[model samples]
Target: MKVFKVVCICTIYVLMIMGTRPTVSLFAHELGASINHIGLITSLFSIIPLLFAIPLGKKIDHLNSKITLLLGGYLGVLGIVLPGFFPNFLGLYLSQLIAGSAQTVLILSAQDYIGRISTKKNRNQYVSWFSFGVAVGTLAGPLFSGIIADLFSFQITFLILAGIGFISCIIIHLVPNEYPIKSKKSPIPTSKTKSTFVDLLKIPSLRLALLFSALILFAKDIYLTFFPLLGLQFGYSNSTIGLLLAINGIASVIIRFYLAPITNRFGTFNVFIGSMIISCVAYIALPFFPQIVIACIIAFILGIGLGIGQPLSISLTIDNAINGRVAEALGIRLTVNRLTQVITPAIFGILANLIGLIYIFLVSSTVIALGTGIAGHNKNNRKTDVMEDSRVKSI
Candidate 1:
């Protein structure tokens, strides 16, 4: 129940952040940002996370999550409100950097919080709840921001979202200073922290999980960065674009409610491969359909494909982590995730400029399908090697 409460409160905080996303991209476009400029601006949002995620995670391992949660919450409000006052490219850049830093703490802390509180038996359920809440926030964020931006202005949208973020900051105090399920293992020594990164990377399963996470986030970054531009090219209004984005969220939410049963029945790895295949097809299909209804259907399919990977990845990281160092392991996951977020848009932005935007979907989908195949083949090969080693020992 406490996990649910934390998830709910944190969901509000996430709503503020997700709400700002589309507003920032579309606003930058409106401000005459070239596709390259939009990509650069979007990349700025992850710079702090890419740089600081592991260090932040190491710090969080020793501290109460409440402190970091509050810190991130207040910082997020400041970042959201900054552009409201300045209303320019300079303002957007600064807002993203600060917001990125806030997200680095918020996300790591939230994941660590739920992880520490739940036993292995219910960890999946807790993560599902957290992911489910996040889906809600994301769905609501675009819908509300789109309408407000349409009816009012981007600046007005910023101020209102900031107000909502500020309220969530107050609500965070309701979360207890500590959870009942604290780890019994001693903390890692300060000297070993450096080696922890190396040690964690040595795990084959964790390494695979990290790769999957990076791939998933990379595809997501492509969607978030390019979809609005695609919608505008189709001559859709801001409200229409927002509705389309919301449809993606709707599909994600729908899939997550069934996530536990589905993963249990079919297995996470198989589900992951299936989802990527679905996502790859969705991306390839997306470019051809400009009709609103068909586009909405593609977006929904895309959402379901993307949605399942995140929670499964989170569960995998948590299950694989060394007992005392779960937060650090998650930090590594975020570091990998943020790396893709930082690189994908900038690279694709250049590509979009050179080859045209529609073809980007095809290009990206190919990469996704290829990466999935390579990773799957390697996993199977590893299993075969282990089986052969066992056979030799038995002989």
Candidate 2:
């Protein structure tokens, strides 16, 4: 498959997701959601994904990516549209849950499709472009949603997001597949799933990378939910808050363009650790700054760190995957990611509600810093040579 097409398809899916995630938090807030409800609603997005991750990965291993994409597209559209049509707290829950499930399938299919399609020599660059699409979608999604929300209402913003999701669905159908599904030769082809849960645990590097991914995403996901709350506290409009989050996405888009070279020079491991340092400092310091411009600037800085960590972690995970289990390994990675995504908000909401919202960042920074430390000393961090990363893997 051509790299651009895979990237295009993947970008469409992520765009719709990024559009809905942050805006939904604001929508919930308007519905009188307390911090606890917001956290619970935020965490709802990962619940279905957490349960179905591995099974969905196995489906990619045995079945076709095209069908997976189609399913994801439909669910994604349905997920985002629910709140627009219903406009209630229950709507928020359904929207998040379905979108999460859709994302689990869409991501697994795209990553596996790319893994099978790319060569070692070009893998880093190709993946960077793919992730850059994610950055772009992320950049565009909330900013667009915020403007739309301010001009209209959060409910209208939800309709626009639903439209984005539906557009992605249409794009998926129209786009030509670079790697069409393998035609069945006999009754069925043999499915080669690799890396059992126990076997995966035996490898220190892969496990560390997975943990790193989960923690990093946890910080980011929670940041999306909390940043808006923080903004509202300071009396910023929903549109302004969106721009604040969008600054992070914009910085990430810029950084992702240069991420491959950065990875090549510093090694993914080192870059990942550095990202954690930046994120920790930025998140911890965010509590002290109530100014919108300053928060936007800090968001940009935090974006640089996070922007680097995401693709590098994915690369590390892909490089370390077992035979024919790249999708499965990715599935496990997401399982961890979604688990952290699910639990962190659950705890974060209550704690933030009990003490203060600032502590969420404080505790998150500390947790991420600890995870980064573990990753820095990981046994499997030796796979620095991106040119030789074409090993058979599952994730």
Candidate 3:
């Protein structure tokens, strides 16, 4: 049953993200939007989710997981289908807002479910599978959308994607309920007493994790936002751009599937550090190469870095959460990531207009290198703490 739920959620994610890149810019262009307007459209999705993540996560903690999952799928279906009918800038913005809300609910619920079902001994392995599912969907989305857009039209492709979302809804409905361990004897907290975003911010490891996640996500945002534009600048077509992005996804999926075993052997911190270093190299090399084949190769390496880094960071964050606060911790991490997604692209877009797209990759690489340094510092501090604790016990 747990596997079934995971599969269903992954399918929904693939359909949604697959259509996002293809439809968003095309929808904006169809509505006669400028590059600034396109930026607004993209930013809305992340901004809405950033604002609502904590509240929605708190809500999930008190609700039935099954219902939350079902509602999320339905919301996704509604969000996807509406844009097909409206097909204007306003419609595009509204769709993004709704889709963002749906993503918040689905992600929080799914993470909470996975956290509850798995034990500490196997938690990292389960989470890796979850991440792999996400990677698979993300990889498949653009490829499928590109094929549909080429063979038919963007509108029809969106409609088909919406249909896939509805199927995911049905799958969620059929999934067996796997509720968290709630005490039936205790009263649920009221809104004022419920866990607030401020409450979650007090944990030091979570705080560091959120900061690191944001930086990493900001770098990724720059890549996703400008890669297509870079492709165009180098005389690549829409289909070729889609294929390159697909390569990125494929690399991510391949790496994530095997990430758990590697982390198990080397430790999470080691894998995190190594992956970030590799990613830094990939981003630095990206702008120096302009050929389509070389760019794809660089993207593949970047994807591997991303795949390893994200799940390792998430596992570390979850491990560091206060007891029974895993959902809240995940929510905070996602909030920070979404916030970066919103802010980084807007800032980079302006920079792109002024300095050119090449600088975006170079600047992003520098930011990631800084994050890697922070992660390394944190790892050292952790080792020092452990050593001091052991010495005190020996005495």
The whole-model lDDT of each prediction reads 0.87, 0.80, 0.74
Q: List the residue pairs that clash in candidate 1.
A: none
lDDT per residue as tens, model 2, 75-143 = 888888888889998888888888899888888888887777777788777778888888888878888
Estimate TM-scores for all models: 0.96, 0.90, 0.90
How well is each residue in 81-115 modelled by candidate 1, as lDDT tens digits? Answer: 99899899999999999988897788788889988
Among all windows of ten consecutive residues in candidate 3, which has the lowest summed lDDT? 183-192
1 against 3, candidate with superior lDDT:
1
Clashes of each: 0, 13, 1
Model 3 scores a TM of 0.90
When summed lDDT is taken over every stretch of 10 residues in candidate 2, the lowest stretch is 181-190
Clashing pairs in 3: 18-141
Which one wins by lDDT: 2 or 3? 2
lDDT (0-100) at residue 6 of candidate 1?
A: 77
Q: Write the per-residue lDDT of candidate 3 for residues 117-235, one digit (tens) a residue.
A: 88899888778888777777777777777677778776777778888777777777776787655622212233556455666576666677776677667766666667766766787
Root-mean-square deviation of Cα positions for candidate 1 versus the true structure, in angstroms: 2.2
